[model samples]
Target chain A: MPGWLLTVWAAVVAMVVVFTFLTIMVMFSVWMERKVAGFIQHRVGPMRAGGFHGWAQSIADSIKLLFKEDLILIGADRKLFQIAPALVMATATAMFVVLPFAPGWQVADADLGVFLILALASVTTIGVIMAGWGSYNKWSVYGAMREAAQVASYEIPLALSLIPPILHYGTFSLATATEAQAGWGGMQWYVFSSAAPVAWLSFPLFFIAALAENKRAPFDLPEAESELVAGFHTEYTGIRFSFFFLEEYAAMFVMGAVGAALWFGGWNFPGIHLLEPGSALLQVLALFAFVAKAMALVFVMMWVRWTVPRLRIDQVMTLGYKYLTPLSMAVVLIAAFWEFGLHLIQD
Target chain B: MALPTPPREPARRHHYLGDILSTIHSTAKGMALTMRYLWRKPVTMDYPKEKPVIDQRYRGIHVLDQQLCIYCDLCAKACPVDCIEMDAVRHGKEIEWKAFTLDYQKCMFCELCVYPCPKDCFIQGTEYSMVSEDRNDFVHDLLTWKGLREEEPS
Candidate 1:
């Protein structure tokens, strides 16, 4: 193959890989969510779908959704309604372009990886708003407005919370940030780093903001089934409904992947440093370690979701604006001083 | 049931720090409770596959030992809803049993008829499944066998 053709070929393969990973992970998350929710409520969820705790439950659900009628509202802005889910899904997938899965396995390790991810995530809100407005329903518009308000307020704190790690790593790239945490057999993760208090404060701030961004519980006003009637995706049915669902879990994994790279030492594990660098075995092990870390964070998201009840819209806004934003700003200030001191001493 | 919201705190005492801290405290407690339940056995019974251990005194459907019934009309008369009906043909010392039906739709499983039975042979059994598509199917015949059986006492 020619050099340019090889580049194009590699890009195609990467897309296929990421898309496959996203679908499988979303399916698995759905199954995990049901099982976890059931376990908490003292009932067995989906016991006989594919046997052995109903492993194929989500797969069966997706297949059912696929054959369902693709409902399009008569009063909807047809263009925007049709495009909304695709836009949301695209942004979520785009975030994976910067996520360094293994040591050198990322599709595109952009210099502005962290910044680009944060930017793209907020764009998902625009797609949501489009869905709401385009649906031509009062309830859908309310859901959209609520989502806009929540995401706008939460994004500030979410972005601010990343400053400590970004400052410590001295780069905007997530790969660099992750590599910096590889010291001390992966014990030097940001939250436990030299700037302990700042990183510690920032982590919870980041996590809460991330939860709000993802529309997770205690902050899940948008998708409040009891009150909202399925929220922004109310008019969506069939495969289109599944797209929004897919976007949600995909976004969760992106958040988890970003968190792992930024704070939890991406692919670095104890005894990992002993392995030969750049070796195929090392890369494979690193990929597993990285994915395991990310998935653990995703599991925590599910655990918190099941544990907490949905917050009212006002309360979610209050927490995002009043609590998280101020706290993250303070963390950022301390982080700046800590990094400055480290820079002078090391130089 | 009406849900109890958190008590509204006065503005003087309601600082963000304290409120957030209390939220965290309560959330941790709730999470720990759920986590404990996660490891505990699920309380759900797999119906159709695993039958429940019904008590000996459970009032389900009536079971009549026809040979011991003695053709008394007291049990049928004692039924509050008048759901029980029976007839027997006399053949010298032996009795030939006919239909002994109880309309379960009206019977109520109250065991009212059992107390009036002189022979103590009319009683409720623990087989409680009563599902049917036809209305007449609910009018259950309590007798396991009709007419005089070989096992019946002469």
Candidate 2:
């Protein structure tokens, strides 16, 4: 085969694998969320569909949504409205391409991997804005504005907090950070180290920012259903609606992956040499481990979602700017000073 | 006696080191809770394969005892949704009814029909899975006591 053909084949294969894994992950997460919510609320979730505690509920829901009538509004901007969901879904799903599931297991291990993921992740907000504006409805426009503001504001603290970790690890590549943390000792994990207090503080700051980033609860003012009536995608139906759902799950997955990479040591496990670059089976197992860790974080996100009532839009802004942002900056300074002091003491 | 308000501590400034330590402490607390629950038995049921035990008083589908019905329209009057429609025919020489029809489509399953039946003919059953694509499936036929006697004799 020609080199171009080989490259095309590789890209196609990569797309197929990523999409399949994302679909399975979303389905499982949906089922798990329902089950968790049911247990917490003292109710039984879907039980009849495909048995085994409604294992196929998500699949059934997807099929139902697929067959439903696609409703488009009369005054809606036809082109942009249709394109908005596709943009959101595509951008959110694209993040997984650069995500390192395990050592040497990423589809594209670019040097600027983190930057690429962050840039692609921001596209989801643009999609939201477009969906809101294109709908020509007042509520959707408000929702779009709120979502844009929330995401844009939180990204400041989120990116700043992330910087300390990169400074300590000395690389932007996710795989390199994971490699650095590979050890049985607590010192190997960034969270436990004394030199980087910012990294430790960043965990919560990033978590709060991620909630805003993904539009999860407390920061979910954009889609305050009672007020905005389903937010920016209120008019969307059928597969268009499914696209929004896909984007939400994909964003959640990306947030979880980023959290693992930055704070919890991506694919690194104590006493685990199985994640070394050479063995394919080990790489696959490590990838599974990485996903498990991500899903665990996702579970925590769900727990927080269920536990807290959403803050008002202003409160959300205040929390990000007035509290989280300044706190994160202070942490960065302390971490920097601590490192400097340590160097001076040694000298 | 009026109680004096407790003296408040001076407004603590944001300390980066203190905030980092506090965040770590809180996260450790949260992780401890999560770890504790992770090993505990899941509160999930295997669902369809393992049916939950429902209470005996749980209301389900309604069943009519044809032999005991006296062609009275009490059940029809008592139904809230008006889902029940009953038709009765008296045979040539008898005061008792022969044929009867009851439409289940409008039945509210409120147990009102069951309680008001003069002959105690209506009863609620445990078979709740009565979903159907066709509306006609909801209609039911009840045999009169006379019809049962006549069929037996024949």
Top of the candidates by TM-score: 1
Pull out the clashing pairs in model 2: B83-B106
Best by lDDT: 1
Candidate 2, after superposition: displacement of residue A41 in Å?
1.3
Candidate 1 clashing pairs?
none
Off by over 4 Å in 2: A185-187, A194-197, A274-277, A342-347, B1-97, B101-139, B144-154
The lDDT of each candidate is 0.87, 0.77
Q: Model 1: residues >4 Å from true position, as ranges?
A: A2-8, B1-10, B70-88, B101-108, B113-115, B130-141, B150-154
Candidate 1, A152-214: lDDT as tens digits: 789999999988889888899988888888887767877777877777777888888888888
Q: For each candidate in turn, give its C-alpha RMSD to the true structure in angstroms.
A: 4.4, 5.9
Per-residue lDDT of candidate 1, residues B1-154 (tens digit): 9899989977776777899899889988988988888887899987787999999899988888876888888988988899999987878878778878999889888898999889999989999998999999998887767787668456
Instruction: Give per-residue CA lDDT, model 2, range B27-104, as digits (tens).
Output: 567655544554556566765457777666666766677655666788778878776666556665343554455567
* Separate DockQ for every predicted complex: 0.64, 0.13
Top model by DockQ, which number?
1
